[model samples]
Target: MDLLILGIVVLIYFLLTGYVGYVAWRRTETSEDYMVADRKAHPYIMAMSYGATFISTAAIVGFGGMAGVFGMGILWLVFLNILVGIFIAFVFFGKRTRKMGHNMSALTFPEFIGRRFRSRFLQYFGGAIIFLGMPLYASVVLIGAARFLETTVKIDFGIAFILIALIVAVYVVMGGIKGVMYTDALQGTIMFLGMIFLVVSTYYILGGVVEAHQALTGISNLIPAEAKAVGATGWTSMPVYGSPYWWTLLSTIILGVGVGVLAQPQLIVRFMTVKSNRELNRGVLIGALFIFVMTWSAYVVGALSNVYFFRKAGMIAVEAAGGNADKTIPVFINSAMPEWFSYIFMLTLLSAAMSTLSSQFHVQGTSIGRDVYETIMRRKGDRSVLITRVGIIIAILIAVVLGYILPGSIIAQGTALFFGICAASFLSVYAAALFWKRATREGAIAGMVSGALVSLFWLLFEYKKTAMALGVTRVIFGGPVISSMPWPVVDPILVGVPVSALMLVVVSLMTEPPSREHLDKCFNGIKGV
Candidate 1:
């Protein structure tokens, strides 16, 4: 009976999703409509869509599971998510981005940056990076959602992975950004309600909020010796300052994702989806509230699960999941939550994965077809949309392949890797384009290339997780890291972002300034000239 009920709910969800896609497809006609939804999205849709796209299965499943291992210290990212991802992104970046996008008639993020600098190389280079790098992030999301389905629905992981990729691809290819946002609004609402229940139910099960936290604090002595050696003070407390674990949490996990959200091509393009600055401003509270509930619930519930599991099963979450942090949330839900709630939470997890995956595939498609192929070929019109659809298909295939191969405990770290690289490669130049008229094309290019290379080098050589994935340390150096630096665990963003910003400043000072005409158009609204 429970299986039957779950099936009925899932089927209805698919039908509604397809109907929404059909409506969006009917509305989508021109390239502008397909790319940016004609820049006239409503405040509610815009806010919810942005929130949904920003918070993915990576947050709820991957990071939630991470909380199971690392504890509530991950809550710092919640503060950063609200402050940087929503507040600063919408207020400081959104207004300028919307105006500049309109002034330049830019469609995609790469196109915006490219036109801002008036450089085709930067445009193509940015597009290439998105095409190459985004699949890893997309794959991690796929793995996250698939893992949940595999755990809950008794589905094969490979089958679950392919189904999600295909379902998202169909709507995205047919309806474009309009369909993506339309579906996202619905998904976001589902996610919000589901997470609220999840958190409330968790606290209820743990006896109460204060009592749950107190139980969690009581288990500080249970910290594994291996974890303690690396500076884990307790599940409820931050790691010892400047310890190896602290660097991983602060530099790699928190800072990498917190700072990196600013430059994500998928999220940045959202600014171009609205009609005016007013709509962006209107979304501030809704977006903030949505993000706060979703993230806080995940971390708090994940931390509290240790108490529940230890009391009931005599094992921690990671141990229960067979040492895979990615599996902790699924194990907890299946073991702790009632069957009915599990079904609802399954939809929540699906919404989280689908909303994020749809945006990622869309951005990747646009990067290739509109930013790279169309620009290089000097083509336009309906053919470009067709090419973008094809690109989406190809990207889906690549992400599915990656989902099958990625190692255990990779979902959260993999997400941070992608975000960190985006910050390193694009954030400095992107910020300069928006707010600094003195920034030169040479500076943008220099910053982009240097930042990208430095980030890549650090990941392959210095970051232990990525190096192990690449088999660099094992194959080449026969150890965890190639770098002999005192603090080897520090994330690449700590180094790459600084170097990228410095290069941007020095190169701009040395190079000729952008033309008066370019500056005039770029700052038209802001300077009132």
Candidate 2:
């Protein structure tokens, strides 16, 4: 019976997403249509796409598990996510990105950065960086959804990974950005409801909030000193201040994914897909509400799952699970929910992965095929739109290969490396292009170089926690600076974003601004386009 329900839900979701892809494909005419949905997206679709791309299986699976260990401290990240990731992002960044993208005929985020400063170097470098960093994050998301299915349906991990990847690739290759956004709306809805149901049910199963709190707090007196050192305070409140779990929460998981939203190729391109400031303005509230529920519910339920396991089942889910925090969410869902409800959660997890994976695939493809190849790598007339579809296939294959070779530690690091690099690499250039009229090409180049280099070195050497997370074969620098210190030494965003911003200002001042005529070419089309 449980299997039957799961199968039916999967069938409906696949068909709905496929229909959306077909519709999007029918509407698409040229490469621009495929890459950016011809810049004609409505506000609702734009808002949902932003929401879907922002949250993924990693949130429910990896971070949820982290919550089981770290407790409620991770909630601070949920707060920042809606504040910076959605509200500030739309009001501050979205409108201008749309206006400028349309003005310069840019179809992808990398193209936007390159064209804004009149530099192919930025375009090529931006594309390369995304192509490199996104795969690790992408692979993590892939494992997240795959694990849910493996637990619920008794499928093999390898098989689940392949099927999910292929399904996402099909719609993305067929329909482009419109397909991704349409599917995102549907998937985002399921994710929102799934988390809400879990949070509500978790409270009931644990005897509501008050009882759950008592049971959790009671354990504090009974816990071993070792358990306390690892940062469990009766599973009800935040972790011990500045424990390893607390430090990871502050620097890597919280600070990284929250600010990193600004530079995500998938999310940034959503602004470029929509038509006007009005569209972005209308999209803001809907986007914020959806992300808030999705994040808050997941973390809240994840922390409470500890009491469910320890008291009712006598199993410490994290300790029993071999210290792989990513598996704890799946372990919770399967145990807490009925076998049938677990199926619904499985489909929800699948939808989260697919919606996010499709956008990442689409963004990577457009960056490589249009922004890098035709504009920079190739020195001829524009290539056919079919080339991007081909590029999507190639990109997925690369991600799959990396996923197969993926390490357990890198999965734990979540989106930290990518966020730091993006903030450092493009945040300043993006800010200058949108806010400062005195922005010069030299300043943009300097910012990009400084930001990218800083992120690379920091992630490689100073950030020993990230290296330990990767579980790599070789440690060139031997490990993190302060293993004894517990936290990441220099978070890439703190190190790189400031350097990127300062470099942009200093270089722009040292050099002349672009000629007035050139500046007009990029900025004059505020509704003029």
Best by lDDT: 1
lDDT of 2 by residue, 420-485 (tens): 678889888888888887988899999988999988766655576655555441355454353446
**Model 1 C-alpha lDDT per residue in residues 32-86, reported as the tens digit of each score:** 9999999999999999999999999999999999999899999999999999999
lDDT of 1 at 390: 92
Q: List TM-score per model, in order.
A: 0.98, 0.93
The reply for model 2, stretches above 4 Å from the true place, is 221-244, 377-384, 409-412, 469-489, 525-529
Over 4 Å off, model 1 = 473-479, 527-529
Q: Residue 501's C-alpha lDDT in candidate 1?
A: 94
